[model samples]
Target: MNLDTLKQLDLDDREISIYMTLFRLGPASIRDIAGQTGVNRGTTYEILKRLAARGIVSYFPKGKRRVFRAEDPERLLQLAEEKQNALKHTIEQLKTDIIPGLHHLKPDFSSGNVSFYEGDDGIELVLKDILATVAHQPEKSYSVFSSKSLRQHLYRPFPNYTTQRIRQKISVKVIALGEGGEDAEYSERKWIRTQGQPDASYIAIYPPKVAMISLASENYPVATVIDSVEIATAQKVIFDTLWQLL
Candidate 1:
């Protein structure tokens, strides 16, 4: 019998081996099962005790000695069902108890908030937050200062970000700082000619927040999210002024 699926029930390799050996050999003493499975007698007896407690194995007295054997394999399906029901209960508890308690611990946004995130996964989180913010707002638009170098860094980790944004119908007005970005479906591009290489960074201005992202090749990718209405409004004004000039 294929016993690989037994691991899902949290059985270790030795326990699985001993159980299968018992299943094959019928009722057997610990010494016999241990020798067949190559596990020591003491450990095999402990494993059998655990399996018996879980109803996966049963023990009966053979004279003065106890003989152990596997229960029906159908017990595995019952164990899986129990695990699934437990997961559903945990989800319900989180929704009803845990999340509400967490919401009460949120910090005040009026004092201004700054969050630092590092690595590619951290950058994706910031991008996802931006998308979520725009998705909830009525305006459905945001502004970006798109650096060519930054895009090169970002495309590798988030190739489908733009596609997902377009699919959500969130529009962006972009001020391209270097070369070679085409207008996408939900975006408008305005170019700013630079004398030399532009700084390797991107700025995203959205409602009540602004995000600054660094695309430095010397280190891991990083992003900073500033949650302040005053700062975001000022950045939006500056972007608009440059948008008109370019």
Candidate 2:
């Protein structure tokens, strides 16, 4: 019906255009089909050949010209069923192989690496990372929150990370800039605040592992996390010194 509909079957733009044109135009030669679809003759022919091999199209010779016709639309349903069965078989095979295979798989996280994500997706990543660390070790987890620029999405939906942290009995230490604390009503009962300097940014301290240094840019968030135990303790020390002054 539409390019989007065809794409669900994994047909790209050209394939979809050609196939849909054939469906609308009835039996026609490759050249006519291409003209009707606004696709080149060669590409239309190739797509039709692929479609024919899938048994959703058929071709027959009529005089000197070849005509192509779409199979009944019910074939689309059958194709989807075939895919479902194949995925089930593959998943069953994966169950047999995944355990031993996983033992051999090693994820390489560079000592400190940089990853870039845009918009709300980026914020979600930061939220997940922070919450997991908090739940893992609540008492030792601390956050120094500042909102240099994070007003637009301050109240947006974050994936139930806070609830998870609370359920795990993670103790959170929140240190906010003076106005930063006033801006949002954070549920973390253990919190500290300071006023002034709205552009100073936010810092998160998680014990034994990661510390996230996030800047609250109004449009997006930018943060660098240091996960080395050595680095995390050094950060905790800095936070302690700051906490004492507050």
Give the Å error, residue 9, model 1.
2.4
The ten-residue window of minimal lDDT in model 2 covers 182-191
lDDT of each prediction vs. the true structure? Answer: 0.87, 0.66
RMSD of each: 4.6, 6.5
TM-score for candidate 1: 0.68
Error of 1 at 74 (Å): 2.1
* C-alpha RMSD between model 1 and the true structure: 4.6
Off by over 4 Å in 2: 63-65, 80-186, 193-199, 204-211, 214-221, 227-246
Question: Could you give candidate 2's per-residue lDDT for residues 157-228 as a string of tens digits?
Answer: 474655666665555555655443432223442244435445645566675555344444554655566555
Best by lDDT: 1
Q: Write down the TM-score for model 2.
A: 0.57
Cand. 1 Cα-lDDT: 0.87
lDDT of 1 by residue, 77-132 (tens): 89999999999999999989998887567664633389988888989899999999
Q: Candidate 1, which ten residues in sequence have the lowest lDDT sum? A: 103-112
